[model samples]
Target: MTNLLRSIRTLPLLAFLIAIPALAAPTIIELSSEASRPAINDLVRATVSAEATGTTLGELSKQVNSLIAEALKTAKAFPRVKTQSGNTSTYPIYSKGGKIESWRIRSELSLESGDTAALSELLGKLQSSLGVSNLVLQPSPETRKKAENEAMLDAIAAFKARAKVIADAFGKPYRIKQLSVNTSGNVVQPLFRATAKAMMADAAPMPMEAGESQISATVSGQIELE
Candidate 1:
């Protein structure tokens, strides 16, 4: 009976010993690092829209379809350009007394190309029947990917440099406990409203200036000191 009581008394001490590592304090430091580079915009994207209104939805739909079909035919003539049909929306127009006066239907065509000259020429042709709704110049996917890879390398280097500085300041050796890296990029958006309006009045080729895009990468995580 005395031995059984002694064993029961030692149970709480044994449990405390097993939990010692879990109770230990964590020593970690959080840090962030980033890198960025410039990439030239090599792709052009444009959105052309055709809108029509009629007394009946059927008439409006027919008109819009004809306009889109013509645009698609013209776009297909250029083998290097990429074209896709976009959104089609139809809505009722209300009169002064809230009565339905007409139905308006709008359809969009999206165009993309690395050859700016060809895209410009196509845009000029389509503008006769469609209005320029949106235009953007950006880096191509391949270019963006290359830039991101480069930036990632730079960011990782910067992160290690910073981590070393931190370890030196802390006067201890450290190990990476956790880490994460991210990439981002920016595209230059030039005003195109005036340009589009000017193109509508003239048949001359659209003037294009592809600016630069900024690609960036960031590294963030925690390090534990030993």
Candidate 2:
């Protein structure tokens, strides 16, 4: 029992000794580097919605559904455009007396295409029966991936250059103790919107411009100087 007690007393000292070497190690410096490139937005996405209000929920739903269905069928005529159903929502409208006077139903249709002209023309057709809710132009997956990879390579090079400069400034040899890389991007959304009156006036092709997005990559790391 006396021997065991002595060993337990030494446990704290042993741990302190074990941590001494790590605490006395060389200085660790942290640095980060980034690179970015503009990628062309080759894809277009548009959201169109149909909404109806009626005293009967079933009637409102039917009206909204019929318009969405017609929009989908019309979208089929554009071979380059792909169509999909988006959100479907039903909510009750309240009157001044705080009572449910009518129900409103709304449904959305999402369209995407690489051919901007075809998509623009399709939007014009869709706007005749449905309201344009949102429109976005962005880089395609392949394009974004390529841009990110290129940026990552450049960022890595920049990080290494910075590390070398730091080591030289300190007059020490260094090794990477920890490293991490990340990539980010933002989607390009245009300011143009189609109004109900414009859509009803004539079946004219909507003007569209596919913008560019900046894709960036960052490399961060800690270096241990010896």
Candidate 3:
């Protein structure tokens, strides 16, 4: 009975002994930091839309469709793309006594995975064929997440560098204790937008400038102080 008591007492001590090293280790303190880089290391993407407007919806649709087909045929360097077909409505040109006089119809073609340089050249030729509807630069969801993670790691690295500086200043060199991460993206619009023009016979060819675009990733990280 006495030995059983002793064993029970000793078992608790053993447990504590095993846990001592883990408890005694210096705890790392966490510090958070953020870093932003403008227009660096980017994944380039482009959004191009073709629009045609006419007195009648059917006419607009037919004209735009014809232009799009020609663009596909004349595409010398641009990637072969499949544009999503969309329809848009325009208010009456002149409403007389609440009666519809004329209506406009527009179709949009949004495509992905086209070569940059070739796309620009194609655009130069295309604006005349199909009037540019809209354009934007951004990363897809998957690419965005990837860049965000990369940005976070970069921020963490920056944080580590700052932490080292602090430690050196204090005459106490340190190590990374703990870390967390975050990231963000912005939709930046272009300064200039292309004008509207339909490919009419003998009209001037488009002067397209599908210039190189930029994709940015932001990384933020928190490191624990040791």
Candidate 4:
């Protein structure tokens, strides 16, 4: 009986030792994946602001208001044309102090549409009337999603390629352990800032070219090494 018990205990110990090599194998390497794409739609937001000076707060206010109203009246068909009036106060126009400029009101307009051509035409029209203060273009949601997915797929492919290379280099087969990633997309907006607040201007319409804006997304993650 003593011998039999000793053999049983030794057998368990032997099995545990034999299992160690299979349980804690050192044959796998770590791999990672990352992807990124441009957020196109999210960034395509454009704000057109018009700036002008008035002799007094009331006078500037009236002019800015009038111009915005007139622009809207003409652009009845244009979509996403939103206008807002901003604060008015004395501001130095050209570093000339004590200009005692009466009122400095601003009219802001924003447009969000996929039709870049129409938007450009509308922007040109707006500039022709209201003097331009600033113009900003940003991406939209649709663009962002598309770009992000494309980037992610590319990144995953890249990671797989790299893993293949590593596995081949090691001269043995490997399996994936774990994979994870983090990603971020930035908004890249083009800014057209005018010295004066944008308003219906006297000069020729400012030509706007809303060209293809590159949106970018970046993804980073690790894959379990096998």
Top candidate when judged by TM-score against the true structure: 2
The TM-scores of all predictions, comma-separated, are 0.82, 0.85, 0.56, 0.63
Query: Order of candidates by lDDT, top first?
Result: 2, 1, 4, 3
Give each prediction's root-mean-square deviation over alpha carbons.
Answer: 4.2, 5.8, 7.2, 5.7
Model 1 misplaced regions, further than 4 Å: 1-26, 193-199
- Residue-wise lDDT of candidate 2 within 1-226, one digit each (tens)? 9999999999999999999999888999999999998899999999988988889987788888899888878888998999989999989999999999998888888999999999999887777778887999999999999999999999999999999999999998999999999999999887866544345666677788888999999999899998
Deviation of model 4 at 50, angstroms: 3.5
lDDT of each structure? Answer: 0.86, 0.89, 0.55, 0.58
lDDT of candidate 4 vs native?
A: 0.58
Q: Return whichever of 1 and 4 wins on TM-score.
A: 1
Cα error, candidate 4, residue 60 (Å): 2.4
| Backbone clash total, candidate 1 | 0
Cα distance off (Å), candidate 3, residue 157 = 2.7
How well does candidate 4 score on lDDT at residue 208?
Answer: 52
Clashes of each: 0, 0, 9, 47
* Pairs in clash, predicted candidate 1: none
Preferred candidate (TM-score higher): 1 or 3: 1
Error of 4 at 102 (Å): 3.9
Best by lDDT: 2
Tens digits of per-residue lDDT, candidate 4, 95-168, equal 36745545566767655556655655676677665544545455566665666677777877787788778777
Encode model 1's per-residue lDDT on 20-81: one tens digit a residue. Answer: 98777667999989998888899999898888888988888888899899989988888889
Ranking by TM-score: 2, 1, 4, 3
Q: Name the 10 consecutive residues with the lowest summed lDDT in model 2.
A: 192-201
